[model samples]
Target: MENLKKTLIKAARKAHQVFDELKDRPSSDPIKIESYTGYASQDRMFLKGRVLEDDNIMVTKSYEELKRIFYSFKRFETDEIPGVKVLLYLDDHEFQVYTDEEGFYTLDIATPDSINVKPGEWIRGYAELPDIVGDDGPVRGTIKLRVPDSEASYGVISDIDDTILQTHVTSLFQLKMMFVTLFKEASQRLAMEGMVELYQEMSTTPVGGKNPFFYVSNSPWNIYPMLVEFLKLNELPSGPVLLRDFGFGMLHQNEGYRGHKIETISHIFRAYPDMQFILFGDSGSKDADVYLNLALEFPDQIKTIYIRHLKDTKNARRVANLINQKGEVDAIIIDSTREIAADAREKGYVSEKFVLTEVEADE
Candidate 1:
């Protein structure tokens, strides 16, 4: 493992040698909108997207899609385009915002309450940046806004690593994670067994209720587009993905990792104070400790905690102990998503008949 780490570090240094020379260079090309998914809570909308150089080549269909996956890796970040104008248009209203120093912008705007934005539905909207232009004209793209059902029993806040996807966060030195991220395409990575089905069932209500799902990860925003593609490929319920910013400076920083995740999850809780949340994470990293702290802080807001047990028995016991200390919140440590699915069904969180039907169809 130490040798592998050294090799990976050498390769990264080599890549950075080239990256360093180009990092300070500026591009004259117009900026384009690279919008991530957005989610709404109550009367406010939380919007996040990046302003990047308009250098992507258009792709369509099967073969082209494969090429597009490669193009995603080569995407250029226009960090120099900070303070550019970005407009979010919903219905007849337009909310104007500016990109931050990292060329990433987030808009938290007050929107008039409306019943038209149904739960589990993607609200269609256009993001316009008139200064940014492509070959044909001004840079603009369709942005989808996801809203949770008003009658949903509870909302879901999940971690990306190990819970839904096979990221070796718990593996020795995270070698498998490095291997997969370096060589595999989003479609090539495998989803956790029965996770997609279980999530779908949990998100559905008997009266066609649609709960909201949010994915929080330690990964930086650089891979947001690829993660979105992976979620779409696996047919997982889509919601806003909150990711951190990574640059030369972030590499040496560890103080903010836990705090950033806590802040993001707190914002969601504040956004929808009346809505209960189901927390899904793994025992790999600080998830167990983080979730435990969160449940203690917002005991009423959290309905249950689901922690996927990794192979590390010591870590598992530590997490189980932490969960056991929190008597107010119902927490469980399981080796698979199927166990949670069965528990959820038995506890009236989902319909078993619907899950069986969907699984049969997929088979």
Candidate 2:
């Protein structure tokens, strides 16, 4: 019995050592990379990258196992790459490998022990920059690739102005000033407290196998870099960002506002009909209304909708009423980002999870 125990321990140690070695191996060939400056809202930005692939990839393990493998890369970060992060569940995870002197990080994933991820479950890879305290900080970037054994294919569709950056669209003048400045000064501002947590939640959520995050914003294209810088400063999650170009004609229709957020959501739903979505936005605009409408229209596709309350407004009541009327939707509205996170742990959305922090005065 003692001999058998010793053998088991030795095997485990050997397996761990092998994993460590595998984590450190470099890619065999240089791959083509594309970089984009992604804006989360008016206040946040993320530097995102993707390694294009023409062939199908396979991943081994259950969806849970695949998620775990992706996350296992977390043990390998050095001080030189502060922005290096990992997202995983079961056997699948993504790593933000170290960057070069040019401030670029490449992603390389080894074929898994088994191939379980179906063609529909494959997803692109992405990373967010590390939060920097000062305005003049370095930019952090990430790269992604397909792995063997993955069974899910996914993509992200997110809100832009408030969800990614700090732009408050409700006040059109402030929003315009934010645009006029090109978000230069504002992008350097500190991240809102709990924003990191909120972003982390968004990035790591399990969506159709392993899709890349897709960000949709109302801000015009010129300030895309500013938004990316803002996300780096906040150390938020990274994904493919879609920004509104002023020339897109919709801006002309919205009275100078550049994005058709509702339409964009509809487009995403149409694009990936089988994919699940984890929606993030604020109460300053029509996010709540849009998400509510989405829940009504496509009940199965949306997994969760997280709305951050910027002010004490009737929007929360209206959201609640809408949910009550439909009797569907796993949604919540909260004064702070942390509360929204806490509620996420519960299986279902409870009123207590989204209760307002402020109290109303008695008439």
Candidate 3:
């Protein structure tokens, strides 16, 4: 493992070197702050975004879908702006942050103790590059942060690759995964059969409110924009999307190296201690083991777990053994959305209308 990590680091350094050499030293290009949806507690706010020299590639092509695949490669070949100080404004408060070597900035700062928010409400803010100017003022990034409602029953923490989106993470060399992730546009990408409806149903609360959904994926942050667009196009319930850093930065994080999903979900759980969660993953990854063990540790907070069956016998058997070992939490393998909906109905996690409306349709 140590040797393999060293090799990956060396390769990453080379890639970074290549990117640095290819970019123009001083150009008239515009710099922009690309922000993602953030989540917050009453007393603290957690946020992240990137500073990059905008490529100015036209991403939208209503007529030609394949053009996006060509542009996605350019997004991966990012023109990062590093060591730049950024200013973030939340209401009347101000916070200062700086971009890392990868042009990514992460903020976990204290909010005013007097701040009050109802769970499920979104707080709006903005991030600005102090040095970058626009027609009126500095170029800014609009930020939205979600505050979980204590009144809600549970939130969802789901895997993106196979559980929701149809990225074949199990394919040889992950070639199929790369093809779908890179070559396909957001509209061209496929969500699993019935997953769209299932997730939509899952988001509907009994009081007609929407429960929160957090997406935890091992996908690098470079594809954050692509994934966000994919969710919007597919109409999946959007929340804070916690993706890993790419290249050398990924290897340095101790917890992230152990399991990105695990570390990310644990942080979410800690953030909303009173809120229960319905865990979702696929059998293709180590999701079963990670989620199952988490259920043991936070048995009270985890309502149940659903593992999307991918026909991996060895992994399935291993998950089965773990499930048997800790039968306190309800964990099951499901081959279809219909199965999950049926189980969820029995447990009162979802509405009767959801199962009746979702399962009665074609698979």
Candidate 4:
């Protein structure tokens, strides 16, 4: 009886320890969908709100639950609305959901039973409501949830002012200030040229049909919405967006960007083992340095590096040399969209068969 009592006590203590560990584990809460309404100046038609999930996970207060619930809200004018498509990504596993109604849809994600997620994980959700009759045909958005024990394949670390949009940050000291003051006027005066073509090219499937366009930007968090709108307007392929927070003490103390882009990229590479990346940036910033370091660190995972030339020819050449030293760049071509496209074609980067074609400005 004494031996049996001792065994029972040991088992009870072990069970309590396990329960305490689970209770203390971190978790994420369901993200609420926000709606909006706007107009596309090109079409001059009313654009209805199509709420989408952001690419990052929405973290909840409870950290140990190991489960996440997400709601997708979509609305259209008529019953014949195109079906809503939802993409849920947890680590390397991706789940797709389709909704037939013009209302709300929900999903429940539970952690894998085998693993006890320690610090929790990030789960991202994306939604698209394309082709609504009597309204603009396209509506797109995304949502995110954080779960326990899950891991992301890759993290997007990006530069904001130029790579994602048309902002010339190097020339303008306070670029975001300039944007806030001039974006509306600029949107009215200047039409986006070649944007659609560039987007189409980037959105197409790669050689092995791998999805490789993740975003990492130097821009601060305050202007994420503006950048997102700009990308959507251009019909560009969207991915995870990482923004720096200027308000953080690091920026004030370091006199440099708050987020160490190279370090972030390195961390992301470690987190997502199966993920490979195509690095995109402009010559206006330290993207060359950051990407060069990344290539050196993760030579196998980095497929190609595309840098937009926003600097003088001499400066651009110097940056090119840095990338060349990295040894992983498949090719480095400097020019606008047309010239880059031509070079890409010549190198068999654009297509399997090299076909010489004229690069025209896309409308």
lDDT of every predicted structure (CA atoms): 0.75, 0.48, 0.80, 0.46
Q: What is the lDDT of residue 181 in candidate 2?
A: 37
| lDDT of model number 2 | 0.48
- Write candidate 4's Cα lDDT for 71-111 as tens digits: 10111111121245544433355555554222233343334
In the range 45-83, model 1's lDDT, one tens digit per residue, is: 787888776665332234355575565556434343577
Return the TM-score for each candidate structure.
Answer: 0.81, 0.48, 0.89, 0.50
Candidate 1: C-alpha RMSD after superposition: 6.0
2 against 4, candidate with superior lDDT: 2
lDDT tens readout by residue for model 2, 153-246: 3344567665555565556456653542332333344454555554554444253233346667766543444556666656665555555534
Which residue window of length 10 is worst by lDDT in model 4?
A: 71-80
TM-score of structure candidate 2: 0.48
TM-score, cand. 1 vs. native:
0.81
Q: In model 1, where do residues sit more than 4 Å from their true spots?
A: 1-30, 55-80, 112-120, 248-258, 352-363
Sort the candidates on lDDT, descending order: 3, 1, 2, 4
Runs off by more than 4 Å, candidate 3: 1-24, 57-66, 134-136, 254-257, 356-363
lDDT of 3 at 316: 69
Top lDDT prediction, candidate number: 3
